[model samples]
Target: MSGHQMPATESVWDYPRPPALLRETRRITVECGGDVVADTTKALKILETSHPPVFYVPPDDVRTDLLRAAPRRSWCEWKGSAEYWDVVVGTDIRPLAAWSYPAPRPPYELLIGHVAFYAGRVDRCTVGGCTVLPQEGDFYGGWITPEVKGPFKGGGHTHGW
Candidate 1:
């Protein structure tokens, strides 16, 4: 779909406006500066239209010490305002590398404290053993795995779409 390689897969267009959260049992790992910052088998994947799933890992599974809350905040109509976190691993500091919905809406209450990392900003982000490709824009934090085919919304030529 769009310009991306399309395999027999779920179309991002079919996703819902309020988004859907699915429990992911696959191994999700986020590594940065040669250190595994977050790894878990219990993650929640948020699915939205024109975007790949954004994996949200539980705070308990993540190395909390590595994340520092940033000053910036943004609003999401469906989820609520989001707060950013910088992933600092030794000398490597990825600014605003992750985000979470502090007080999400009723439908997304499960994401209250869950964190989702930017796949491209981190050294490596993998799902089910396959490295993921970050969604093509700075705003959206979708993780594009090989198993997911997308005409993702973000990056070039999609501003008006």
Candidate 2:
């Protein structure tokens, strides 16, 4: 990645202009440390396109202190075998809430080493003091933010996730 900083004029958002397949909602609260930025249920063909329901969170939004890189790894044809992270909270830890393709495929070069989180795993998923609603099944994270409006996962025949 070129390592260009995000433009100052642009608001920090995961998908500023999501594809026709995606819909996002945004809200900010406290989760990791600085803020609990929430974007709710997004993407059409999301499972097929974006590595299976994982919510792409900007690293700044997550609590890095609690995340420890783990030896465990898994691979995908698109991105390499992902390196895993174990999230530590208090004395307890959830083995996996984060993943990254350090050396990604050419098409996904922008996302290399950029971690994606599984909202389904982490225990504290709060947005604006309210614990956000978890989506059906193990959808990665379509955070619950008012900005998100969608039939993202429920459109006619949208199943097969």
Predictions in order: lDDT: 0.91, 0.48
Q: Candidate 1: where are CA atoms >4 Å away?
A: 1-8
What is candidate 2's lDDT per residue for 1-161, written digit by digit as tens?
78855423211233322322222233333244333332333211123322223344445545667789988778666555678887776666667666767786655555554556555566556433445444444423454433333434422355673
Q: Residue 110 deviation, candidate 2, in Å?
A: 1.2
For residues 1-161, what per-residue lDDT tens digits would candidate 1 score against the true structure? 47855445687889887799899999999999989999999999999988899999999989989999999899988898999999999889999999999899878899977999999889999998889999998999999886677788998888986
Displacement of residue 98 (Cα, Å) in model 2 is 1.3
Name model 2 segments beyond 4 Å from true: 1-52, 124-161
- What's the lDDT for residue 136 in model 1? 96
Best by lDDT: 1
TM-score: which candidate is best? 1
Task: Give the least accurate 10-residue stretch of model 2, judged by summed lDDT.
Answer: 43-52
